[model samples]
Target: MSGHGFHVHGPHDHELEHAASGGGHGDGHGHADGGAASLSGGMSMTSKIAVCTAVIATVGAIFSYMGGSTQANAGLYKNNAAIKKTEASNQWNYFQSKSTKQALAEFARDTATDDVRMQGWQVKLARYEQEKTDIQAAAKKLEAEASQWDAQSEEQMHQHHRWAQATTVLQVSIALAAIALLTKKKWLERAMFGVAAGGLVVGALAAFHI
Candidate 1:
């Protein structure tokens, strides 16, 4: 032992050993931090998906409402025009009957009163006919516009619904993936895969409906 100019067990050696043990403890803490970071990352991703689902659902509902409104307006316009046409036709018939009665009652065959009455009746009839035509034309135009609006609205609604459904599926899948990661369950991971596959099929079916 005296032959070695230094002591085998020095204070520095003990200090170095203690520092090495401390470094191992730090390494464990580092691993825990890394795990926590991974969990947080998963949660952030899930939150994003949930937000997207909400947005898509809102859009779908709006489109459905708009389509319904257009259909209702179309029906209203058509009904109103039909009622007006019926009323105008009834008034014209009444006027024609009155004119015939007055003309027959007069003993004079070619009286001015008869001519004036007939002319008046013709003018009323012409006005009624024009009104009827105008009403019918307006009704047709409104109906066509309403139908076009309904078609467009329905298409938008379908698209929105499809997106909403897809978002829901994605949200579920993300939740499942997070659980699988946390619990390290093989079954959950497999189940998540199945859910994702089913979602894709459902989305495809929705697209076909569109």
Candidate 2:
């Protein structure tokens, strides 16, 4: 009877053993479920971060292109302004020379004593006056053209400054996006998007010459 009692489990002990085994199996299943959930969550976070990175990269590339194009345009305008200024100066000098000739012809016509000599000087003075009129018209036109070029160049430079500012902001936004991915901060990501939006607005303005 003693040996039988030692080898045979009672009903209560059997129930406890079964309960313990079932509890262990349930815990293992729970752990597996939790692990799967964690893995899924990690993948979702990574996907979001990847998307953010791609979008930020695209915006940054556009900003860089706009900034570079604006800077190039500014340089081109400056060169055009220089050419126009040089032409204007040349025209003014030509006008001055023509005026000197006209003045000399007028003085000679007034002072000539002989009839033939006075008549010849009067004809020459008339020719010089007509030439001066033509030269004055051309010089004034050239000066106006130079002034227009100067204004245009200044406008281009202003647009370039806008584009440069926009590019700087976009670059900062890209850095913030990278940091957002590392920190997994949704608010930081949103702020980065905000800065990117501002950059886009500025870039658009630059493109439109506003």
Clashes of each: 0, 0
Off by over 4 Å in 1: 1-114
Model 1 agreement with the true structure over 48-112: per-residue lDDT tens digits: 54564455345445434544554555555555555655555555565556555545533243343
Residue pairs with backbone atoms closer than 3 Å in model 2 (clashes)? none
TM-scores of all predicted structures:
0.43, 0.80
lDDT of each: 0.60, 0.79
In candidate 2, residue 72 scores what lDDT? Answer: 79
Once fitted onto the true fold, the runs of candidate 2 whose alpha carbons sit more than 4 angstroms away are 1-31
lDDT by residue (1-210, candidate 2, tens digit) is 576665667998887897887954687789999999989986787687678667767866876777777677767877777787787788778878878887887788789888899899888878877887887788778777777777877887788788788888888887887888788888887888898888888888877888
Best by TM-score: 2
Q: Which ten residues in a row have the lowest lDDT in candidate 1?
A: 103-112
Per-residue lDDT for 8 in model 2?
67
